[model samples]
Target chain A: MNKHLTVALDAMGGDEAPAIVVHGAEIARERFPEARFLFFGRESEIKPLLDASPALAQVSTLIHTDDVVSSEDKPARALRRGRKSSMALAIEAVKAGDADVAVSAGNTGALMALAKFILRTLPSIDRPALASLLPTYKGECVMLDLGANVECDASNLVEFSVMGAAFARTVLGLQRPKLSLLNIGVEELKGNEEVKEAAEILRNSDLPLEFAGFIEGDMIGAGSADVVVTDGFTGNVALKTAEGTARLIGSLVRDAFQSSTRAKLGYLMARRGLDGLRSHLDPNNHNGAVMLGLNGLVVKSHGGASISGFATAIGVAIDMARHNLIHLITQDLGGVFMGQSVEDEAPLSNPDKEASSR
Target chain B: MNKHLTVALDAMGGDEAPAIVVHGAEIARERFPEARFLFFGRESEIKPLLDASPALAQVSTLIHTDDVVSSEDKPARALRRGRKSSMALAIEAVKAGDADVAVSAGNTGALMALAKFILRTLPSIDRPALASLLPTYKGECVMLDLGANVECDASNLVEFSVMGAAFARTVLGLQRPKLSLLNIGVEELKGNEEVKEAAEILRNSDLPLEFAGFIEGDMIGAGSADVVVTDGFTGNVALKTAEGTARLIGSLVRDAFQSSTRAKLGYLMARRGLDGLRSHLDPNNHNGAVMLGLNGLVVKSHGGASISGFATAIGVAIDMARHNLIHLITQDLGGVFMGQSVEDEAPLSNPDKEASSR
Candidate 1:
């Protein structure tokens, strides 16, 4: 680990800013003792919290910024007018080489725009993708392009595959991670033109990743692949849908336990076992969403994440910085593109004609 | 209820076709005593099963058709070459007015293709959408188009809203169902061109259904809206993702209860309450997916559904037929379009430009 590794924090972002940010940083400091912190927010609001944690205060530098990117602000507006906002300043810190990474829990659109504008994407990447780890039955898996690019073409999906595989290697520590394109069906002939075209290219190419064929949404939680790739729109919907379902089941279980005295007693006796299940499925255990393909590391925590969740996001940012995720992505791109532009690759000669028939 | 409502069954479809099909018919007979059955498959394979259920045999007419559409057959291939298959014959029965509705536990692509070709679409409908009821915290909600149309234009989505609203009215008996377009965010400026355009049209038009504006995927399971609409690819992924999450939770719950002897005793005491939860989340309770906007009612059951699951599918078909789902959709479409075609409606002058910026 770099002794002087620094992380910039958007302390004025998120639903419960400053407090969560300060407490989260303190928690993260214990895990990554060598890491330094740069807090950007209203000094008046953050100083008292920082003072409470003397150790964190000693290693942290607070930069005052009253300007904040509001939750309702449009991305364009945020990018144009939020130059002095905490979110923007934190990202700028990364660009200025003061901080190795930036972590925010602000509005997703605003965060993406600022990160892209400040950090810029790697030379080989057209658009950076939002990649996150989701809990599966067999531990966890990484899914990419989660609301980053709503409409992705063949080349864009191929780029996501490379970036996603690189992310898995850095975070999940899986070498030659098995990847699959998210589709409606597992059949080779299913899905739209873009997915079918992307699959054809990946199948023929000698990319360093294992291109497992198309996977259905139902198989995602079964850990069918290490990396699941899709256009932003579908990925976003799928991810949110999974979260919603988990909440629904949790609510139903609570209702069931309260239905009868016997069930209530059962819940008491089974509390320990259920607690393990709860922790395993908790969002705090997996909170970081990295914007892959960016030149500098940028992690987005959930807007409503607790202190622990925010700390987990910080840990993710530190891990990416330590592993050199950007370098890894560039290397993976070099292996496949091989001095040729993505557009220069041969187009699919015969895309699946029957895809749109139904 | 129609005293002579007849349903055509594709007896050769599904993983365990002949037995599940025959047993499912017996179960449906108990619910809808007025409904008759026309079984289309090989009489030799189906006779013994039908004979075992004497009551179902009394109401069912076995029609011999040796040919069957395989699950692997492409939709286009099935449309061209599967005219004599059991799936085709069953849909033909609906086209010939021999049955009020057609129910099939078969390959979705093949079933959709055969239904579209044989039964045809309504005059005002460009493409039929696949709609299904999903269990939610508040009863159930309807979602579409679950892989019927991979890519949909603004007009197609508008048409789906009308069709979905009608389906909700028929099945859920809501006078003015709350409808929402599934997108990544609930903001007015979020999502792609087609979704934004469709939302604008729905907002401005005097459609019978209550337009509840945009909804995120996480709100779907909370029953935030009565009808949820999206393009086929996204809708399909979201539905499967929810199912996958539910199954994951179920597996986790089982593992938790079996972790210790005390937990096992708790499970024994809580078995009744847990059973209620299991039945509530069971796929068997919601097995049918209807091809909305077709001239005739066509319901597709899960290919791997058990006897009870297939029975639930038949129950769904009967409800649609009884409530006249086709006529309701025609009425809803007529009210909105009036004499003007969907294309003639003014297009979105200023679609959200920031949609693709990120």
Candidate 2:
């Protein structure tokens, strides 16, 4: 999608870091050999993994960086101590205009914070949120602020709507992403004051999203709206709950398949159909979480993401680089809401209601 | 659960009222022959359903009433008109000490309005809310304020948590139910100002609940906590979404079973298992929405619920009477918190934003 180009990879991050990360990078590289890969992390840790397979050594470059940022480190501390940190260095590559886009499967908060701190946000952009694609019965549903900003206001929600639409258009490659506010209730008068106010603002805002009125929790998996935008709080709950339920359903289906000889026989007959369903709901196919509304692109992979997840995140980064997603969001939000250019938008305080997760 | 019961049934309330309502009364009558039933509405319409069956001999009385309340009536308007409505007549029967409890599968707003306006709220209660038992992997979870109140404060949430715990224990026969606040995120400071303040109040105040801390959306069906509490805004979302998803999953499974000859054989062999799962997740099993904190028991059934659902609502009402639930919640809240007993606690409003429903 990015026309085969280079991407800055964070090798010393995530649960299965360096190994799974390196393996995923290799898988991605083999598929698109023209795309150059810059691996910035501890060379000692990553080199062996790459050397174990000659194919990975071909398209990937191992940058010598000795520091590693633990997921437990606070975003501010990580960035401050991370000038030499692999994560910070990888992000710095994009900020310094070296790497086209920076990608990581590490701490999301740290990634968003460093991306905003280093590369900065576009005009009228207060915070940059990680918007990810959720696979549903009706294909993929785009949800933003998965864990980015928690205490988001009406204005911040409006910004998310704008940014989410742009991401859906560019990365998701949708014509006009249908947008809906994620509220506790579908009624206009319901929810905390923030949601009611956001509904009014989005109703009048110039964002090109097809303002599909409101979508409730039921409609989320039902596919009522193509792109559902909300503060990080509701978004994270919906995303995690849906993922958990999907996983639970998968487990139950597996149990059913093994419960009896007859079910096992049916499963054997419909192996292809069952496999199709499994692949459709696979987390690996929809892995990358983009930090939307920033001047430079940054994508966070699932920390516990598998190899397929890693490859998907890399492809997402490559795609964003080619499309210049930030430029598009900047231009759109700047012209419509703040009357400034994308590059000129000042950084507003991220209205993140930090969840219990690290 | 109540060995012998008398229930005032608003036969003219729901979409299939008079028919399904009468049918449910008959079914319930069949089980409990001594259970007194009052059919309040048009006598002409109900006499036929009763006369056309062998169950008519057990029909206690046909209390002819001319008024009918539509589902669209706002609570305030419904309260004014309910004076002459069939639903109001039913409540009056409870007030007159004729029936132990009043059950309606009609307008939710009307039922709540009449219950509060006629039966009034418990002294220690604020607003009455619809609390229901939802399906769970563990068993059943008691969740409250599904749609009663919209704009709630922290104090209200604390109260809901208390009321939810008490109802589950007294009626559902749960012992020391673990309580949780339904939040977008589980962090102490993750929710809006109301939730944030409520979390503080719950942390300090005395209530009968176990106070398990904040639980998220997807956690509802997962049986994360025994009792989940939120304002009606969020509770309604969780309830409706779960109901809708259950319906979706049920239909999908049914279709999957009928997809092919092998699938049909699998379905036949596992028919009991599939039926058990269906009944386990059946909305009819969870048919009534209780308006808790009221002076008198008020339970709302699904408008589209059939005979089974209505019968379940009646059973809930009977169970409430048997347990003396209103007294228990008040005593539980007061004994745990402050001021005399919980029965002495329902002041209707707290400055910290604690109202029962909204």
Candidate 3:
């Protein structure tokens, strides 16, 4: 394991560009003194910010980029035209082994496309999955395929299970995570063909993980499993729905506290305790969403993330780089494909061919 | 429209069967003085419960049945063997015109299977959908296909949109509900083939309802649209995820209030305001999940519903019955199928044919 980690930052990305990137790297630097940064952005904007933070400037190498990928740019467009963009350059650094990992808070689609095109997928991985940590009753659980592939086949799901389990092991520090497929119902007969097929495959596999048959959406927050796996479409909807519900309840709580004079007084008295609860549910606390199954690590920070949130994303990349996430995923995938024929694995390697054949 | 409504109750269903049914009927009778009830269950158990409530007994007729559907029974097994069961009998009453609506708190899959088989789908409808109200920032919104159809085609999504819109109109009292398809993203080219196809069809159609394009899951709680439509699998997951998130936050709030003496004192002062918030977000307040697009109204109450929650389910059925929910759906579907040919519509009417063809 390399004690000195080098992280490439897309300095021009995110809602609050250079300022957030500069400040966030400084915070991350304080925590990880051995870690160095390569910032890719316009020299004019990043230089001023770096000048303000002498400590961050000392350990960071500023790489100038004339262009940046906008949030509105389609993945295809970004891939075709954003070669010299900060987001693309940061990913390129990882691909070229100049940096151990890349951290970005830019357009998700653009980042995903650029990362896939540059870093490429590992030999055993069919598709890369977007995995993130969600706050649950029993601390936090990891869920994957947030929005990477809209439609996933049985092979894709099986591949995701391996990658997600590997991620939980690396990030959550679990030796053998309890993994489950997300279905409409926990029953054996429930859900679509793809989910059922994946479950059957997992049940028969000799993987070194506890395969907790199936779990419903409600059980996700209750921490029924350490790793929750699903197709991107359902996973994306479930994740967003959870976010919306939390926000709705949060607003309602605020409204309640302001409804009456007594309530206002009560809120003042309970402010400290409520603040603790607030931080626990805060998105910034769980900001990093990693793109797993790639040849190199790429951690995506929320576009609207706070300074600490971006730092958390950098922290995720550091952990994965130090822990050898790519190597772990490669070894896990080898176990998955041991019993399968080469013909069964051919279609999943190329998504374009798979789509055209379908 | 029926001025005098008759509701059939599956008295053998739910966690606290006869007691919740009888007490709930007593409460419903107060709200709708002209409403009558038909209780189907074991004579010995229900006779004693009905005997305790004279007012409810006067307006209710107990129909003894020996069989009941267990919660663990699969849908196929329940349909094959539960012919004379309480849940089947309740649906039969609706089919026989002995009841305007049937309310059950039984196994959801069993209830859906029996209701679909007995009542059948309306002519223009392919499948019946499970519709429910969810609390949102701007009051409440209706979401459909909660777990009815696992994999829906483009036409099925269009049907859900019409049924969901009709539901919002009849129950929520909206003149022309703002309807939207649930997708991974709000963009036109964002989701899978089915969603994009449905959106294209809707954009070109002449339906009376407001087609607000696509909405992501997070927008569901923001009340971005009055009627949110999706396939059964995704819809079910989203609804449950929202429920789970709300419960998670609620528990955290309780923990915050109990953390210290000052927090406990603050909770006492804010008790009244917090009570109002609790009721606003209470599952009991939004208990009923209606099986929409059926020939007759069938409301499914939560198995763990309190007396008030069961009454709320009855209230929903009463509203649907009185407003002629079937007729509204029929009229709405007429607008939807105005342009399509008969050959294009044949595949949807029979789910068996649709599945076999697939």
Candidate 4:
């Protein structure tokens, strides 16, 4: 058995709510036998689901919370009114050092707001950006600031690069990850001032990262870098567009195979190969968005994710906590900050600052 | 036969040079029997290719030029020193009323700089944006500012929406195309200041375009809107990411089919369906990117595009010329401008003005 790592869960969050949340925890518990869980939500709803999974019930403690934050609630309103809500309480467990990490399948804006407010950011970190694992031709790559900050300046981008590198090292297990700035073109003269400036800084930085220079969006799926950094606006759009394209192609492929009787028979013959392809591209297999630069580790799973997907998200949080991701990130950021003591002070109201309020 | 439309070709541009340009024009000649061509390049190189196609030679005039803008040349350098280059002459042909449109497969930055200098912007237009046809669930949609201007304000986005609508009407043959601002989220509170402002303006505009409100990037391939508008940086990233995702899936599908003998046999049986999918996703089928908001039409073909791809680009130019796209764009802008006369005077130098110089 391994060291016990407690994970706080927002039981009332997500589309499926306490049912999938408790069932996913059961699946996770079987995978990680030493892990313990704290389920926060209405006891009446969660007790029944938790009771169904005796294995998870054995290692879990139920904490009742009547208040639940709706998906439609704004971040600011959620922060003000959701102090004792299920989502807030889970994050508070991490803040109080009662849990190693917090995992939620809830509203993204509400989760971010509560986590930031309760846990606060690291001393050297200005803002926390969302980082997630993306499958690529080579294997997997990490992309940051997915939708956390809309308009990032050069410094904010530089910070994202630092945080992204740390997250890649912890999650992807790369000793020296190559980082690249996302832009329209690879040329130094291309893109806006912020992209160009961030490129220059990364190119000359004294950090341990291998700066791969500017990489266009097309190069992302090619696995040109271990870490891809961009402002939240562009990163979010690129990420979503890729997902939409994948879905479109998947549906089109299915339609083609079902178009005729011969095609259907062919699909049956190729079922094994198709299964492999599906397993490789399945969203449930890779389902976690790590909130980096925070004092404690917090993972936001997709609200509409199935039990399997939620389990995968818990797996991600377990890995991050085991590897001490928060400590590693803080150390990396401290080194970068010390190396650039001569530069101007970090901006108080950077891109991510506006994101919380918006 | 349709009315004869003259198209000036930059014979020295593209990876394949005069060979692909001359050959593609021949293919276009077969499709559009009334089209005339003006080939600008070295007389020695282009003469042989032109002679090889007796039909294209019959309706074509070869204009010799010693200077050829290299693909490596920067936009500013190209603009200053490529006055007599093949690319420059092609745009000049349109400005001189010798050709209805110009088409090239050259350095994008160089083409934009030279075309903007030679053709100039329309009286009501502040900048020219690159608009192209993207395949979606519902046929195809038009996306603008692929890489023309980076940092767009609300005004720039509004102008892009107008231009995109006009382009869709002319090229996609839509009566009242549904337009939407490309954003991180569909909510009014999502994204940055510029996106919110643009959505507000588009929602209240008196133009004929159907303002479909905000659309997230993931909704792009779902055919949610006929025209998607955004700043150059985000649009460029999203477009390229979609292309990359398509390529990734294509390679993965091939790998899956080749993994086993049964899969290979299945692929053979499903050849008819696979072929349909192949033809649908072929880049050559959707080739040209029209530079809109300029006084004259200029289409940019992919640098590494095949002969068929180049032909598709020529077809796009011919369509734009036949429909008088420039006039329709001017009329659309006039409507939006008249409607917003009560607001502050339009800035002389918007985001695109800085892009040209940078």
Docking class of 1: acceptable
Q: Which candidate number would show the highest lDDT if scored against the true structure?
A: 1
Interface RMSD, every prediction, one decimal place: 8.2, 4.4, 5.4, 3.0
Candidate 3 lDDT by residue in tens digits, A96-204: 9999999998877778777888887777666788899999988899998888778899988988888999888887889899999998777676778898899999999
Give per-residue CA lDDT, model 3, range B207-324, as digits (tens).
7689999898878888888999998889988988887888888888898999999999999888898998889888788888888878898999977789999999998888888888
TM-score of 1: 0.94
Which sequence of candidate numbers ranks them by DockQ, best first?
4, 3, 1, 2
> How accurate is chain B of model 3, given as a TM-score from 0 to 1?
0.93
* Top TM-score hit: 4
TM-score: the better of candidates 2 and 4: 4
Models sorted by lDDT, best on top: 1, 4, 3, 2
DockQ of 4: 0.58
lDDT of 2 by residue, B11-89 (tens): 8988888898888877777666558887799988888887887565465678998888876565566666668788999
The alpha-carbon deviation from the true structure for residue B352 of candidate 4, after best TM-score superposition, in angstroms, is 8.8
Error of 4 at A223 (Å): 1.5
Fnat for the candidates in order: 0.67, 0.22, 0.67, 0.67
Model 3: runs farther than 4 Å from truth?
A342-358, B342-358
DockQ score for model 2: 0.29
Per-model DockQ? 0.45, 0.29, 0.52, 0.58
